[model samples]
Target: MIGTLRTVVLDAPDIKSLAAFYADVAGLDEHYADDEWITLNAADGTRLGFQRAPDHVPPRWPDPAFPQQLHLDLRVPDMAAAVEHAVKLGATRLPGGGETFTVLADPAGHPFCLCQSDGDSTTIADVAIDCASAGPLARFYSELLGLPVTWEGEGGAMISTEGRLPVIFQEIADHRAPRWPDPAHPQQLHLDVEVADVDAAEAAVLALGGVRLSGGGDNWRVYADPVGHPFCLVW
Candidate 1:
């Protein structure tokens, strides 16, 4: 039987940087940090993990030519402040004009969003991504999301933190990178992260094990890990 969503796994050049980024952004303390993986805790029992990838490539977004396969969405108090903060943190503004939402890139070049809402609560609801290696991916996410690796067997890997949200990384050996806007090769899923400060979040991400994939001006920035999975920081 399937359970609730727990943690999201991201591929990166450096797991430490990615974990640090999420840890600071989510306001979660670093539960574990090592060369192989890092994990952060969320209030809702959800966790985020960042795994090391030696050969990583940053993803391109909105271009349609390169296309971002997966990304995350973040909720913020003020859009303008969030955007400004992300830029200082090392995020690149994408071509999208800020309206109801703004698009930004993480250090890995993966796309994520910043949204404005009047809600008083600040919490993370989801974790999403796609990867070729499920075992490694699960382990990576477990550490990043502060989730424990559960159900480790030949079938695949299942992880959960706080015993509520259960994130599963199914084995997909023949996984192919999706091309953006192609429809034929559409992105399967993405992630949304809530952060206090955009710039500080980026810095923390870098400090942990993440790398800035692309950025310039005050628009947006893209970042990546050692493995190439992409995530974004917008300002």
Candidate 2:
């Protein structure tokens, strides 16, 4: 049987900047850093990785032309405070109503939501991504979301923060890149990272391994990893 979710990997043009943004927003510690990759650590030992890619472009959300196939939902104690913190860390706020949860974007422009939850920190809960090589994707995401890459395995990787939320990445032999604006070849998945300053966060992602796809001037921006996975950063 498949185990619990482990790591969440993100592709980007810059790895260092994205990793720094996530590290600042998620309140996690930086574990590893290099020219091509960065890793962070969660309280529970889960990890997040961000890898570099030169031709990365973020997606425009709510637009059918570049729809979001998959995204993340985060839980927090205070939505307003969380959003404020996220914005300060370089996240943008989407145009929408605030109800049960609030939506935000990462430096790479991947969409993610914030809510409130009460559960055991040690229990493996929430989203996971299975990829071909955990190293590249894990490093990419770790930098993008400020999450940490906790574990690395032959088949997959694990990323998390504060021992609460964890996003996992699994290895795939033949991973196919997603094509935006085309329903048939739409993006398969995406991620959302929190930050303090939207502009600073964007810059950080660019410095690491992510490329900005769209929405640079507005509150939200779209970005893509080196492998072409769409993500966002919202203030």
Candidate 3:
């Protein structure tokens, strides 16, 4: 494995507002904060972060043109109450849902799913990524994070780690890969992985079908997984 998964970060024009929205709706606690970044700790040990992006462009899901590259699945015992609560927190309902899951857009315009869960309180169950093929991306992340593939079928797959939330892959018919650093194709979200040795992890990631995108600093470097989703390896 290249490294341990750190935080699932979302790009937002206003980091505080986006972080506040998730903190309230998902019941995550404040872990850290700064002008440009804010992170929250989920009940299951997962960390969610919001990064400041002044020129952020929100995705318009159900429309392939402005795709939702990745989204969180918040599970709650009461689906109706969860949906109502989310809507009250500046979330807008998006068409299409079933008894088990409902879709909504956060104030930042990022799409997320409110899933009917057995758990009593609201919690982040999974971080879902849109991909052209589920198997390959799932495999890439599985090796990178050292998470096992818990399920695979029906154009989707999931990798689960014991303490943190699982990451699921969904095959999108019209998936459009992002060309980040170019605002025309913004990366709405990304994963940050923590590694002991940045150089060694970089080698491991490249060997595992990841491409070096750019350098973050002495301790961190940006890379793109096999399917072009950007991620960072931090020491």
**Model 1 regions lying over 4 Å from their true place:** 125-235
Instruction: Find the candidate with the highest TM-score and give its number.
Output: 3
**TM-score of every candidate:** 0.53, 0.52, 0.97
The sequence of per-residue lDDT tens digits that candidate 3 reaches over residues 1-235 is 7788889999999999999999999889999999999999976788999999999989998899998999988888999998999899999999888989999999999999999988788888888999999998999999999999999999999999677668999999979998887777888999999999888888989998899996587777899988888999988
Question: What digit string (tens of lDDT, one per residue) describes model 1 on residues 166-215?
Answer: 55554444445543223344333333333446677667656656567543
lDDT tens digits, residues 41-127, model 2?
Answer: 767665666767556665455554444434555556566776788888788887654676776767776666666546422222345
- CA lDDT of every candidate: 0.57, 0.62, 0.91
Model 3 regions lying over 4 Å from their true place = none
Of 2 and 3, the candidate ranking higher by lDDT: 3
Clashing pairs in 3: none
State the weakest 10-residue window (summed lDDT) of model 2. Answer: 1-10
Q: What local lDDT score does residue 180 receive in model 1, on the 0 to 100 scale?
A: 27
Ten residues in sequence with the least summed lDDT for candidate 1: 1-10
What CA RMSD would candidate 1 show?
14.4
Q: Which has the better TM-score: candidate 1, or candidate 3?
A: 3
TM-score, model 1 to reference: 0.53
